[model samples]
Target: MLLRRRRFPILQHLGVFSNPRSFLLHPLHSPQYSSSKRNREQLLNSMRDLKTVDAALDFFNKMVAMNPFPSVKDFNCLCSIVVKMKHYTTAISLIKRMHSLGVKIDSWTLNIVVNCLCRLKRTVFGLSILGLMFKIGLEPTVVTINTIVNGLCVEGNVEQALGLAERIENMGYESDSYTHGAIINGLCKVGDTSVAIGYLRKVEKRGCKLNVVAYSAIMDGLCKDGLVPEALGLWSEMTGKGIQPTLVTYNCLIKGLCDFGRWQDAAILLGMMMKKGIMPDVQTFSAIVDNFCKEGMITRAESVIGFMVRMGVEPNDFTYNAMINAHCLQNQMKEAMDVLDMMVRKGCLPCTVTYTSLIHGWCKIKNMNKAMSLLCEMINKGLSPNICTWNALIGGLCKVWKPLAAKELIFTMQKHGQLPNLRTYAIILDGLFKCNFYSEAISLFRALEQMNLDRHILIYSIVLDGMCSFGKLNDARELFSCLPAKGLKINVYTYTIMIKGLCKEGLLDDAEDLLMNMEENGCPPNACTYNVLVQGLLRIYDILRSAKYLQLMKGKGFSADATTTELLISSFSGIKGENAFQEFLQKLVGV
Candidate 1:
């Protein structure tokens, strides 16, 4: 029904298509135009042959000036072409012109208007158009409901979309696959993967054979939720139902496995995909390489890159960034720079992430000059230094015992339009703390409180640990007490830091009290907490209490860490109670 006519011999007979543009610009002035059926048919055919917006507009303008208006289908066809050209606003305006011309509007015409409104994120206007369709005695179709549901999903109103779908079902309208897919995708977007799976199962039970798109949405949600095993279950179910897994499905599962560090399983999945004739894409290779880089398997990551090249999938920025970051993690600055040079030689322009990784690497080795050089190079290349780049520089300067210089870099970053983010603040505060600039750290921390950022538990823990290190027990305690009032939950790290501080000051009783009541306050101690407590008790020569904590630590499946073991062995060796300590050591070491 949409313009399939190829022959234009009739156009020559009508003298239209030869100079179609001129014919469109000038209207036919025949007095008998309203009665000429053949003339109207020729005009409609010519409008369909129009390939450009300019010519289409001319045709439309000339048609509007005619004594008898063009047929609605002819107008609809022109509007459809405009919408396809992505001039959705123009299509809506043309619809208004049709109404002004007293052309009877149909459901198809209104559907186009609803679709455009939805695309523009004006779902409320789309609903009004749906209402107009109903007022004109037109029942909404599946396509109409699907468009509205998708619009609601895009606007993050999944709950309302679900209610709409339910209402449509109650009105005896069977929801189609697209409608269900939209709802499932919305649930996934809102992190309600469990609810999404429920909807999926309900659809399956109702004999609605869902496709790979529906399964893929739920699997992606499950993967993101870190429920990879459950995602695998869905994959198995999909295959059992004769719904073959798509590339997206396999990628989701592979990424989920890689995230969990199940490298063997990921490799097996890759092989399975290849065996099934699903060619590995650039994203597939990037995910593999990135995960291997994270696990410090640099050789394997490089091999994946080589294989990607052989397979005709060119390595991208993500591929090189992963490879560069792997080298940087070990402070192998030369190797990282070589990767950067290789990337440049291959015509792949290095991005912020590429330079940031090298900057972080140089910073790890306390080489601020190299880091600053890369920063300048990136800027010279028209790339702005992101917050990570600044954080790496500041943290690196601090690590090399230049906290004051690191502090200055923070101000410089602000001057360059890079606001100090939460990590930036943490890096600077940590540097100040480690360099024994306690007062400066405290001052900056108080300044952080006035800012609009959420003072996360890690931020609180960092300052608390700093105060504890400087023997400011009272200051640490005051900060600790204010956590609940600030709507911050005290985590295990916070509890452990406070406990260590109390023990360091020889306040063993207070430390023990805090340790015992940690779970009551919803901050249960971890293995690190118990190890610190054991070391603390031993420092005070409380042999009996130290042995008790050691036994408790063992019962919790936590071995005394090397530091604790060495502390006990060195402090008690050749001492008066050496035999009793030796007996405790036997229990700890299973000797």
Candidate 2:
């Protein structure tokens, strides 16, 4: 044993001493040193294979447990992982936790959270976070301010965002291109084009560079608000300033020109865009196509579609739908269906409006079965029919005097959670009246009143006419009385219906009062009112009032027809030889 101890080499002793276990046992290596080494290894491994927020959070928990303190970089990485996962609430919670633990957060980390909050539509909470950052002696960078301003601007709160931008400038932070662009975009979005232009001038005065996006935003806003000339001037200014128009810029101008009915000018602009190496986009083609269709130039519209396909620009659903509507309007059903088939072949799905247009076309031809079949096909294709489609079907049914079918269609609409509009109710009511379904007509009229939709005087007149025809003059009078309380001034049709109802009932006194009221309300009676009244008075043997009305009718440039002369002569049958009555009758017949 003594010989072995003497024979051990110093190299072996150094090797034994360099082992980690031996170092731990040595006085030079404390327990803290071993623990720190273990923690560092774990932290390195965590950073190497990190993928999700949960793993990052677990690693962060272990790190804080090991050291009881985290660096700013460690806290930022954890928060970034949370933001990347869109766990905004959890990210905010981590920020609060990091603050409580006295971990310093940088401006970049604050901006990340602020942007996440704004993207989540939690801008109020984001502003509070900004205030908290200020309270903790942290300054928001220009980028952070720009994010807040852009969020507010997109939300149409440009004034508040501008105030915040001014505050950022007052804090000695230089506004970058993004900052100015956001403010200009916000102002323009809210229709404050004048302010937006002034701000643009200020940006130029301040020597900040203006990009194409900012100019395009202004141009889009100007065009949207019908300031086409101003927008065109700005476009010229932009080109002169060496900024080329983008696809969006040309699209805005094309759409604006189309909206203002300047189709020829829009075409010229399209040619100019092509010559200037600016390609027209789908929106541009759609605008031109829609304009041609609106002008009833179907040939021109089809030519535009061909031109788009040749240019390698495929039409979108809106483009196809517009052409289909044009074809339907022209009653070219076969062409419309062919376009729909083409749409399907191109892998483009037809929307409800496509089917609705086809249905309307079929309805126009009184082909309700074809319309119904197309509607069923739409439903089977998973395109739900809208109110317009149902309206077309119902209106077509009513047009063909199929009121029962129209009522059935109304029930179907209600089952699908679509209530008929006032127009729908009006058509149904008019149909019922024309079909002599007076009871149903009056019931529908009262139903409209119950639904608070009877304020329209036209609806009242329809019901009154039905009542007069059905000899429900009292009901007509009651409905007429309710019109004024509903704030509906009686129109010419209302007075005519009511006066005719009273005349038919032989109520001459009441009819004359209504006639005076008609004139008082500035609705001068037409020939129909005078003729009906004269016939009523003659039937009741009131020759004096009848002669007065006949004279008034003549004064109003109404010549009594042969029927009127015959009626007057017949009314004086018993008293035909009397002198005064005979003279009056003779004068009326001569006229």
Candidate 3:
């Protein structure tokens, strides 16, 4: 038998193939083939009912060794199944193996790989594959290049994607409407509306049909750029072009008009959208309602809600938040609460914005207790309070002279991983200073100093005002000296605070020096600065100096009020009897 098998080498190869079936019948050959074939058949059966990629991958490995050389069709089937399953790594491995085994990867297979990479957000790998395809002389179809362009746009490399689009055109690949739309949308996202409009016109000249999505993108860009009139014109042009506007298109235009305070025009557009039988979506009604709320047209805003419900569109959380914020602005907390109850009853779960609006409303009424309760309720409902929520609470507490409570709340925010922004810090600092917690205020200032946040002129002024109010004039002057080192140029407020500080300490010479320095620094002294200097000199019976400052104040176009005259009269009264006082009053008042 060995001699006969040696003589027929073809039969030797056939012998290996024939054993698998014969083993099922007579048990003569190796059982590996029969078991592998069984597993492969089982894998194929499982693939038909495959619900997830992992299960399909688990099955693919069992049958991999069974096929010594899978046909191109078989490899293609595997590639298609793996791609559909999103088994990208395995799919790529299969493609590479097929190439090594001389299985031709056709254009369809290449496109599938590109698409798979795009879906996986591995567009760079997809582009590398495209380069490989070119190196191997595989012709790229238009769909393949479009996939690349779309992927690039999604990755925010739109400029390079546009270059690729141009290259596609240079390669004689026909451009499609989808490609134009992708480029237009990408350009609009990057705020390059001019180029986006040019592309839109190019696509229009090419007779490629413009869809609602494309028109909506351009309208949104125009709206964001504050070109509301131009956006409305384009809306009309879109309708005139025989392309019906989608709900998104109407929402964009209505929102644009509303943002620009063109409520009358926005209302007309809303009615027109309704008249056109394009059943207005929730966003459309929300936009109009928000516009009405912004204009303080509460009755019109309520009518919009009623119209929305009548039209079978349920008002969402955003709609309720808008009404609540509007009522809050008007200090109508009861109405805002009523809207909140309505929102809850409608089964629309309130978001942080909903709670934030209500909290702000209570804060507006100086009802910090109610705002705190709502904050606790927000936490109980499992909503994480954002920075705005904390800011409102802190600011409200500060307004009510609860600076200690505000500080505790800030610590709570820090423990919860919410860092106080600059505005929050400023509010707290100002609150502490107003409450006469100077030590604590200075500690906060020092802490901020260590953190190296840029020193703002407002912070410096607030600290200086606090120190000056507490009769710490030298400390206030030292703080001023350090301001320039910290790169903060003194503003008018800064100079005014320093002048008041020096004047309050009876340091008229130092006050005058600061006033001169203020002018030298180009921070022109306002009425307050001059008023401080005139009053300071007058306080110590320095009538000549006081009168000189008054004359300078008048020259600077600052009128002396009763306080100025009273200070001058008191100074003159100290100069022995009422004669000098009367003369000083006459000279001072020009009588």
Alpha-carbon RMSD of each model:
7.5, 14.5, 10.9
- Encode model 2's per-residue lDDT on 1-591: one tens digit a residue: 232233223212223212133322233221222246666666745664677766765665555554545566766776677677776655655654454445655677777778877877756656766775676567887778888888888888888888887886897888888888888988988889889999999889988988888998899899889999999999999999998888888898889999889988888989988998988878999999998988889899899899999999999999999999999898999999999999999988999999999999988888898999998898898888888998899888887888768978898888878888877887788888887777787787777779789878878888888888889898789878988888998887788788889888888889989988888889888888788778778878888888888878877888666666778768777675687867875675563
Pairing residues by index, what is the TM-score of model 2? 0.64
Whole-structure CA lDDT of model 2: 0.79
Ranking by lDDT: 1, 2, 3
Top candidate, metric TM-score: 1
Model 3: how large is the Cα RMSD against the reference? 10.9
* Candidate 2 ranges with C-alpha deviation above 4 Å: 1-105, 158-160, 166-177, 183-215, 233-243, 377-384, 456-485, 489-591
TM-score of each: 0.79, 0.64, 0.66
Query: How do the residues 149-261 of candidate 1 rate in per-residue lDDT, one tens digit apiece?
Result: 99998888999899989988998999988999999998998999999999998998998888888899899999899999999999999899899998988988898899889
| Number of backbone-clashing residue pairs for each candidate, in the order shown | 0, 0, 0
Report every candidate's CA lDDT. Answer: 0.83, 0.79, 0.78
